[model samples]
Target: MTVIRCPGLLNCDVVEVPHGLRLLAADGRSYLLRGLSADRLAEGPLPAPLAHALDRLGLLRAGPTRTVAVVGSGRLAIDVAEALRGVPGTVVAELSDDPATERPGGSWQLMEDHSPSRLTPDLVVICPTDPLGLRPVLQLCRERRVPAMMAWCGPASAWSGPVLTESRPGCQNCLDMAMARRDPLWLATAAGLTGAASCWAGRSWIAGQVAGLVAAGCDEAAWAQPTWASWTPRGHSSAPLDPHPECWWCCQSGPAPVRAESECSAVSSSAA
Candidate 1:
């Protein structure tokens, strides 16, 4: 992976991405330094550097469900699968691209050739190291009228859990559009997600925390709205997702209609 210096005098932490390393600064600024040979930042658009920095901070918002499909690999995926094992009244599916890859422990199925049963899982947890890998599962879940959550636990003490769906206000696409609108560098960062540098590692406690959130969400726990939840050394925090005015998912033909129903409740009932 390529290593690069942060332009400002900011405290930067290195985290693995899909292809290369991402430098996350203390100021909530992030930059993708791709490839081992690539160094110096390329000259680009006006205010690109400033915009990239601003894209960093913010709690991700989410909503959740039941009958989960945990889409990911490595330790985190295995941990989540194991944690969800034998939970009464819930069916969990652990999917991956590789068919013959040995799973650590828990019930997992080959996704390449398997078709889900008619009783599809209503919730999907996306934790794949590759950000682009999220697309297929999300698309599949959306087609089945299911909700998907983006979850991860650290190269350090941080964890994020955000739920997404095209039919509602808190979908990942909405989050992306909102971020892109706020910062010009967001689009560029998104494009490099799959090809950027990333590593596989996280703390056990953090993983457990994420898995618990997923489970609690599925069990219809106290989280009542589309909220972004996270954990740090200090404590836990959550915030509601704000729909973008021009979001295609929330506002298709015209302005989005006022929804009396939460995304999870509405879609789960319909899918059921």
Candidate 2:
């Protein structure tokens, strides 16, 4: 038995297959190298076949988002909005509790309470300090037929998502159900925890990861798949969000209608 570990390079098992040398990627993918022309293989200490395998496995891909509406008056929400800055054509706005007191700031717009009714942005991001407090926001997004993403940043420096998206598969209710099932005491525990804490103690890096996902989803990029990501001592791991067949929230709602360009054109208009 032989094993090779390249720090920041590749982690795999070197196995002798009938086809010659093969690399079983840490992600459960296996790549085989049969033969490579001399020129095709660059001048590296690693064999051409192994180098080719490395090249095949090493690029990162992400999606681009356009317009996004952020809901919530917490630090996490503000952090997410800030992260969207500098992306071309990406508009970030906050839904204010008081319309009269609200003022627009750099790179972000401010909207009154019923902002959702006015703007049909590509995606809505709800980042509430109390993850359980998103019922109303979730309901509004559902009624408006807009796609939404939710995030929960909490103490202990742990983060969950940019959760699932509202439209394609997962809904807030579905997420609730899943969380409930995953931990029978989740509701009680979360309530108690949030009740005692005035502000969430989530770490910046974790929040940034989730925020990036929210922005990408808003961009409607190809790699934008709804997932539940969590950070642990080992590292970060993600799992796909699945729809529940008996989800009352989603079942009751029909597919979001496609608003004509003219109707959605006034997205930047007043919520009044």
lDDT of 2: 0.52
Residue 23 displacement (Å), model 1: 50
Worst ten-residue run, lDDT, model 1? 56-65
Compared with the true structure, what per-residue lDDT tens digits does model 2 show for residues 1-272?
Answer: 43333322234554554535455666787766565322222222243233333655741122244677777666666766666553333577766423353524321232223654556666667766565765556556666666666666665435554333343566555666676667767666766656333333354554466445543334445335556666544466677777655555555556444444321222111111
Cα-lDDT of candidate 1: 0.50
Candidate 1 runs further than 4 Å off: 1-66, 86-89, 98-116, 157-161, 165-168, 187-206, 214-224, 231-236, 253-272
Best by lDDT: 2
lDDT of each: 0.50, 0.52
| lDDT tens readout by residue for model 1, 69-123 | 7777655666666555533234567766344554432222333324664535666
